[model samples]
Target: MSDAAWPAPPQGSCTLPASVEAEVAILGAGIHGAALARELTLRGVTCALVDKGEVGGGTSQWSSQLLHGGIRYMLTGDIRQMREGLAERATWARIAPRRCRWEAFWMPHRYWAEGLAHRVGIGLYDHWGAERPGWPAGLSLGHVPKEAFLADPRGVLGPFRGATAYADLMTWDRELTRDLAASSEAMLLDFHEPEGFEQGDGGLKLLHLRDRRDGSARQLRARRWVFALGPWTDGAMAQWFGETRKRLRLSSGIHLWFDAVPGCERPWAIRRPKGRILFVVPRDGLLQVGTTEREVEDGWVPILEAEREELFGALEANLPSLPWREMLVWAEELGVRPLVAATGATTHLSREAVLERHARIPNLTLVLGGKLTTARALMDRLATDLTGLRCEASTTAPLRLWDGQAAEIR
Candidate 1:
């Protein structure tokens, strides 16, 4: 990795503020921070946003890339959450259709005993969206594992059994984040690391930031701070919220990639027999396969695994006939998902993210545990809280900065 993979803020942009008109500073340029920045900037709030790494390069890049409404919640039979999630999921399709669009996912229908409950679940899923007779509203691909493939030996689960097709959005999540950051009036200050903070009379004050590329240092001042740092949310919380920062449980997930089959169509979120969902997500050239969750105690950093046997094991379990013999055309990657754990079922953690205000500091707000598909709606909630502000977003079409694509902050 280039030591300078991330760029420096525009020279002289970080000048220490003598006194600011507004009182809000948002720290950490992950997805949530970028969403907040766009919302606040459009509201004309005075704010300074900072990040330790490249904007949208952290967990945002690691997302499963599903702009889902909440199929997971549907399985739980929660109408309210399912309804809310579907609404949020649609917002992405509307705003960033280029970066986020709709996809039809398949839930295997075999194993009648196990899937009996699931059939009711997806029927509710279709009903929640008011699914149309055939699809979009709700479509069912007729069941049946293909006799040829199943008889061939390598086939694992099958359409031969059948699957329920559900609608969800496939998103270029990382790119959407970069676009959101660009939507903000706040200066896009990337590559600067927060050094420390001090408990001052006015509130918590950021001491300084270090430039990772040049070894130079600078200072920036803001009235208040917001922590949207993904899993790093914990560290920022511990620092400003006293030693009493709320707890967050983090985990790592991995996905494998394969070239689209001879003519496999759009994205397909396949439900495996083991309660794990592997996304058969489609991109221009490749299909995204993956995701096995492993818990991590501290989550401020990215996960790196040169060889993930277990991650692949799950994929192999799902895609039984994958041809390792073909050679030269598959990829595997793993990243951490920062989820707030709740009791009941592991996947049933509150889909609705929680937001809390700092007891000591009135302006600082901490937004925790949100799904990628719900970001725009999260901003909508922020707008609702602003009171008296028009909720209409700007005419600017949403964009996502995949890889290192850069955009001008307006």
Candidate 2:
């Protein structure tokens, strides 16, 4: 499936024209940009969506691919974030059913006290999501049988108290992102890198771009401009705003994939040392074990040999029965995410998306730190706040992507 080809563009349209004009010009084509394009187009605005590479080919594709309600956020008492994610999760299940599906997730508890606490916590999560459509009821198993878990032959090291199973939506992250971009009525320009831009007379923004494949120059003009450059936010900001204090703290996360365990069909939530959360997700007949989170100075950090071993060691400590080293596949992915710069751990930083008008550039907005599950909601808020367009209440439900015949953001 990894080798599958992306859908070709419409017939007779292979390259971007030399010059284009629109009401709005988007500088990135990740999920955020795609969603914003869709939202803006729905509000009767014309947009030009451009990307340095293929849509969703950046950090958007490297997600864990779970449209979960962020159960880990409950630890920090962030019920608002969890509720917002849960609502968005339900929205995805309702609108993009072909691209997303509900999957059962299990979090095993070793000690009785921990098991009880998880039950209470997950119950709260269920309560918060209960009002949303397609929300699943939580199931607390007091004594999950060994057969119910994908335990190692050596047996789990800790005393088995039970497991809690909950529902979360899973998606083909890259495919969904591409579909959103394709569905947007805006002009889609893949492989077009923004070189630089200058403000023209009368508040028009002139953006200089180059076709990455042929190195052909192009000019795009628009009344409004948006920077949804994700991990590249720092670099683009530095180039445009000229060396302001760092606004983003970058973090690198890496995931490794392995052939599925014989009977393991559901995803597992394993608690690592130091209270970090790791997930073993099963998708497309492969089990993906990940992810190691570490703060980095920039977004170009590579996955080291020691990081792989660290992931395996954590898996062995938690689920020692599985063949941690032997079932490894040849593919691994690494992605960098930007968080608000602060003095605490990266995990503690708010995962909420940041949308702010550029201080130096007129009619320019900068977007940072959004997740796949909450992208639509974030963009809806952006549309309302930036464009003064009120989203019709009916458009919130039964959303459709580009794959459907009648695609609309509302």
Candidate 3:
């Protein structure tokens, strides 16, 4: 495997002050951190949101960009997971309709059994999404005949009886994260790097931080601390706080972007013979094909040639007449998923969020293993845990994002 270096995260334009104090100080300005900060701010709590790089610069910026209802989780018969995702999907669609929209995903099936299974899955999916508060009515599965496939621009080569299409919401994950952070009353410290922390006299944590751009030291005092370090959670605890516990397993996912494939206006979900699913999504004039799931070590970002070839092979295998290998790649992205450490392969590991209080530090909370679709719900729970009061229904499900804008302090 050859190493293809990842582009450095963009330097944040925001600067830090000499010292800051907050009621709740959060580390890691990815989606979860941003979401939690927003949640607290909405509850009239002061928050300091700190990150080592620009906001949304971490794995939050790199995703398939689908607000899906855990379609793959259905394969494992995880109904609860599916329902949770669907509920959150509806919430997001309601709060940020301007930022996301419904899109149809078409999947081709080779055999009668395959088609039947897909039909059943779609039926279940539609049933779960029916009467969701803000989302549109559930859509029935649409079929595409083989004769229609012959005239398609994606150039399907193999013979197939038909295809099934269903609907899911597509979003700009990074932009949504930034909007949440910007709309929050939290003090966003984008380029602040945490060095260490110590206990204060009042049972608070005094966090040592350095400005990445100026190398100037600063301190933040807070009553509670939360680490939403994503893939860096386990190591950050060990390095900064000297706490050692197995908390997360890393899975690497890579996506390749090319100039929009002509006439491929919508996303396609394809299942290989071995049951590996691949997605081809077209967005913002580019076609993104991705996401290989393999166990990887933390802090690994280089794109391996094998990963590129694997994605290319999947596309080529599905659309043989298409020149997938010869096509020029406009860009590439690699993100590591922090899965809950388990005995099975990373592919089967849980995406459910885990909240752990530090063994010794009662006020320190560590968040692990959640996705873009479920971050708001996780943060809502975290907020409730920290505040010891249940959020009203209006504070959640009906709160409009990007509304009630907070003044910019960058």
Per-prediction RMSD in angstroms?
Answer: 5.1, 4.6, 3.9
Error of 3 at 369 (Å): 0.5
User: lDDT tens digits, residues 41-84, model 3?
Assistant: 77888999998877787788887788878777768778898898
Measured by TM-score, how close is model 3 to the native structure? 0.90
lDDT of each: 0.61, 0.75, 0.77
RMSD of 3: 3.9
lDDT per residue (tens digit) for residues 151-217 in model 2: 5332355444457766677888887787677657888877776787776554437888877666678
Angstrom error of the Cα, residue 398, model 2: value is: 5.5
Worst 10 residues of 1 by lDDT: 131-140
Which residues of candidate 2, in runs, are more than 4 Å off? 1-14, 131-147, 150-160, 200-204, 393-410
Candidate 1 lDDT over 1-410, as tens digits, reads 12232445444433434233334567767777788777777777766667777778777877887766577665555667668767666556556655655555656544676456556776667566652212243333323235523443323443325455566666666678877887777765567776776567767665477766555676766656667776667756676454554456676677667666654454555565445576666576776667666566555333355335664565565555666325344765555556665554444456466776767766566777776766666765764575346556632335444434544221
Model 2 Cα shift for residue 325 (angstroms): 1.2
Candidate that beats the other on lDDT, 1 or 3, i.e. the better one: 3
Q: Name the TM-score of candidate 1.
A: 0.79
Q: How close to the true structure is residue 93 of candidate 3, measured as C-alpha lDDT?
A: 78
Per-prediction tally of clashes:
16, 2, 0
Best by lDDT: 3
lDDT of 2 at 53: 71
